[model samples]
Target: MMSTPVANHEAIEKVRDLIQGIDNAMLTTMTSQGLVSRPMKTQEVEFDGDLWFLTKKDTNKYQEMLKHPAVNVAYVGKSYVSIRGEAELLQDPSKVKEFWNAAYEKLLEVPYDDPSLILIKIKAETAEYWETGNKTKMVKTLFERLTGKESEETDLNKTVDLD
Candidate 1:
């Protein structure tokens, strides 16, 4: 239940550290059929209340963003993080070039100047993360669960307000 307020710098910095090296995030978007998730490569830029991803307008995710802007981004690496936010489609060419790399160029098979290429800017509202690196905490949690008693020390789970 520990939630970091928006004004705290530690909250945002911790979130950035957690998701720093994650290659891809599962972006969950709402659609008429319900929620759909897809693996999307996040931009290398540090998290500063916003997350960016490169996508093409021809994709279903882009269309879904048009219908519903709410989305969730999940990252699993050293820790598990869940980011809730609203999405905005952008055609900022300069930004595309900034994050673009040879790998992207090879995979997309098109230059960064392609008309369909677009950026998805996620205005993150909150980030919830769980650190699984502590084995002692995990065992204690399991014991507590078995005995139906809560521990004084809480799990290494926190919610950071990004907005």
Candidate 2:
């Protein structure tokens, strides 16, 4: 089922916090045959309800996004975040240069100025996240479960609207 959409600032902040660090995210795109997922380097920038990734114009994902813009990006770390959004293929050279670095140069073996290089901007619509809280919260949750009670401490998973 799809999450109820709410443009709450706190939820957006929570999402940004959950995905702050960690480098890569699994970008899943809809193909003509089925769904395909691949690990792409998550750009080291503020989340702000949107996600960005660098790619080549000739990649299959580029074509998939053109045909079907819906996509999911999953981040696994201390917290797990699954973000759903509509993908847009961008051809701004200046923006690409802004996110370029030595690692991308070494990994992609393509210069930032390459004409084929492009940016995939995911305008996130809804996000669901699971966070592993501190020991105190875990203990509280355990106690609540033992006592047959439900509380905020026991609720570690939630769906947040991004758009």
In model 2, the clashing pairs are: none
> In model 1, which regions exceed 4 Å deviation?
1-6, 139-153
C-alpha positional error of residue 125 in candidate 2 after TM-score superposition, expressed in Å: 0.4
Error in Å for residue 9 of model 2:
1.2
The models' CA-based lDDT, in order, is 0.89, 0.88
CA RMSD per model (angstroms): 2.8, 4.2
Positional deviation of 95 in candidate 1, in angstroms? 1.0
RMSD value for candidate 1: 2.8
Report the Cα lDDT for residue 116, model 2: 93
lDDT string for model 1 (1-163, tens) is 3444645577788889999989999999998999999999988898887999998899899999999999999999989899999999999999899999988888777898888899999998889988879867867887997799987757558887877
Point out the worst 10-residue segment of candidate 2 by lDDT.
Answer: 1-10
Q: TM-score per candidate, in order?
A: 0.87, 0.83
